[model samples]
Target chain A: MAKYRQIREDLRALIESGEYGPRALLPSLTDLTARYRVARNTATQALKELEQEGLIQSEGGRGWIVRPRPRPRRHGIDRYSRSTWAAGKAILIAETASQGMVARQQIRELAEVEAPEVVAVRLGIPVGTTVWVRRRTTFIEDRAHQLADSYYPLDLVEGTAIRQVDTGPGGGFARLEESGERLDEINEELAARMPTSREAIDLSLPPGTPVVELIRTTYDISGRAVEVMWSIIAGDMSSFSYRFKIPD
Target chain B: MAKYRQIREDLRALIESGEYGPRALLPSLTDLTARYRVARNTATQALKELEQEGLIQSEGGRGWIVRPRPRPRRHGIDRYSRSTWAAGKAILIAETASQGMVARQQIRELAEVEAPEVVAVRLGIPVGTTVWVRRRTTFIEDRAHQLADSYYPLDLVEGTAIRQVDTGPGGGFARLEESGERLDEINEELAARMPTSREAIDLSLPPGTPVVELIRTTYDISGRAVEVMWSIIAGDMSSFSYRFKIPD
Candidate 1:
């Protein structure tokens, strides 16, 4: 194997093994050169390749540090619990709160658009039905984290606070409850796959990194899907936790 | 811009859009060539790349077919219900039963091994404590599905039936229950990442295909860890579904 390839694979294993946590600094280029007995240029190239892959970045005096990863706390089943959302916090915020990280949302745009066929199916609405789409880029510590494009039936949300630039306290789901429908359950389907050309550019994911394509649907007590959301999550940065009872 | 890349991206988008169901046939190379106005060689190359990516495969006369992906039934929360297990079937079997596929476990080996530090932490046992490990490679329709290695403290099972090649009736967990512990809950942590070099070869996962790294800890009524399992699931061939109630 090429010297750089060997070094790259070793470092990759270390990261995956959780030996290096998010934002943890990796061995310096000098350390790599001495340990791997390779030329400084070879060591530098290996690190460069890893950077291009989006797994690491040079932090000036801090040298190369693992890109801020989504820690274990970013994913929890209780994220949407009434206590959390009704308390005026976004589920995303609650998901990452255990890490002591504050998340901010930048609403890029909000529009009423025709729902795609897939989204329509999930919402039990006619394809092409006008839907309210709130597009936002979520950030952790001001760095891009995930992209959320949430769709709701326009007819249902048009006159409500959900149609506003800010959905007020508790966000959309809480407002949905205030609209007289209570959210009873949520369904999430997850898949790991390479990002689309758009996602790669938008998320700044490194090469060889996959994205978790998450489709979430929120259902009211009437079993109606009031919200269908598509989230593009950076794979390496996140982990999802689920706790469920074994039915008797 | 390469013609093949254009074709590949379009087809990939279509797959991700759920336009084609599992095992559905993709457009033929001839059709792709005509539709995209690309040379036959270019279209073939596109299909070839996708095949290498494990997104699709070609059967002799059937042309290109979407690789068999895990349907929604494969990701039910009820998979571990007592009824399902007591019926003499693995939860994984129940998960894929809706697809009309039978899964067979090829138990590669069973042995008593010293617990690794991580496993020891999860199992609440001392590091290097003797433990029983049942390593198995699961197959669906004779294709490798996932690798599961389950660990249990030797002291808890040295005199029980769980140490045998076949933990009769339901499964090891069932036998564990019979040995006086009642399962209370399950905690699963899921991460998506590229498979390791050994995993790629063992699971026959295609290059660039990510795997869902699932670490599951099964706890007894008293909240003690009884078993710790690590499952490496092929990303493309699997889907995970979670349904949780929003607290009232």
Candidate 2:
């Protein structure tokens, strides 16, 4: 790698590893030159690039300091309280990036429990009825990215092969397809709010990072709302992109 | 409107107008009931709904408080050194949205002359060219929702019909199209970031709000980049959905 690129990567690594945090000042040009064994001009070049990228800032007398970044937040509609399989699937999607950070393995449990109030209303089921809950978290690059808790009704996944999605080759959707359940439509709602203190620590956010809230419900071929999933994304670190087709 | 809904609207109006800032506690249910001549239930209902919608929150025993929203900060990209028309267009966009509280209006003349180093490199323009800068704030239901800043090249809009996009029937793209410039495509690069204190105030964001940053560039039929627009949206106050056809 070129000298400047190497310096850039090193600096980035230091940031990701938390050696330098937001507002933390970096070494002076002369110090960087001696440490990196590069010319002062090259050090200047690397620092300039970093500043342009909005990763750092320079204060006249204070030199360079890190620009604060929002912690990673999850994005998706709220979780459904219908299937253990769907619950597991939702957790995977939420934690896919973050778990790699903390090196936590994904969970694949398949079981049933009572439905929560929000999920009950969406599923058109009683709030206290049996529902399956599948939970999981992703550890990306050894850092925890997200935590997902999903719920689903028990009738939907019982006596079917839909319970094995968490550990399945293609995951929950694949298992549902194999069970002859024709998945069809989806509805999604999104919002943003502050995370609980526990959530902030888990997502590794600055004290006040907000979480993007998304709740999604999927219907089957019969238009029956079969599954629901909710997710929380660290607001600063993530974005959700979807292409909506405008029907002709 | 129902009594509860009426109360909700009044409070919402006050909040949107900056009568109540983030973390500012609202009147107690008794106080609101006496002021609005509504039952305590109605007052509680109004506050509950707001909390559910993520607009306000109960500070435990301290009563409900306004949530802070994000403010926008402008970053200059290019200066229109010689464009008469471009300058007019920039002013139009800023002027139209400037009056209404809910209307998006923000203008930031990049301090290229003041901080040439940070402004020039981020914009990727020549060091000395003059760039007109504009910033915007979006609101949904009286909450500060998004923040954005744009930079325009001086030459493209200097004498062209496209400069009138802000007030006329067609936006910039339509104006360009009417002028016989075939706009073939638009490319957007998006990211999320934490807001600075200045940005938070301008966006009116509460602590922990994250912003969606977007850089959009329009290309003419011949594939030359014609215009660039940048936007920043508060994670909670706004959500963007776009539709694209799948290529065969």
| Model 1 ranges off by over 4 Å | A1-73, B1-73
Clash numbers, per candidate: 2, 64
Please name the candidate that would achieve the greatest DockQ relative to the true structure. Answer: 1
Q: How close is every model to the real structure, measured as TM-score?
A: 0.78, 0.53
Clash number for candidate 1? 2
Provide the fnat value for model 2, as a fraction from 0 to 1. Answer: 0.15
Model 1, span A113-179: residue lDDT tens = 9999879999998999889999888877666768888999876786888777788888998888888
What range of 10 consecutive residues in model 2 chain A has the weakest lDDT sum? Answer: A73-82
Instruction: Name the docking class for model 1.
Output: acceptable
* Residue pairs in collision within model 1: A53-A206, A70-A237
Report lDDT per candidate. 0.80, 0.57
Against the native complex, each candidate's DockQ, computed on alpha carbons, is 0.47, 0.10
Per-residue lDDT for B1-248 in model 2, tens only?
Answer: 89897887788777767888888889898899999899887798788656634468778888889976544322111111113223344422343234322344433433223213334554467666676544556554466655655555555555554343243443454455556666555555455555544566777754445566666665666765555566666655544333222111
Regions more than 4 Å wrong, model 2? A1-105, A108-111, A117-130, A153-155, A160-165, A184-189, A204-206, A219-224, A243-248, B1-134, B139-144, B150-161, B180-192, B214-228, B239-248
- Candidate 1: DockQ? 0.47
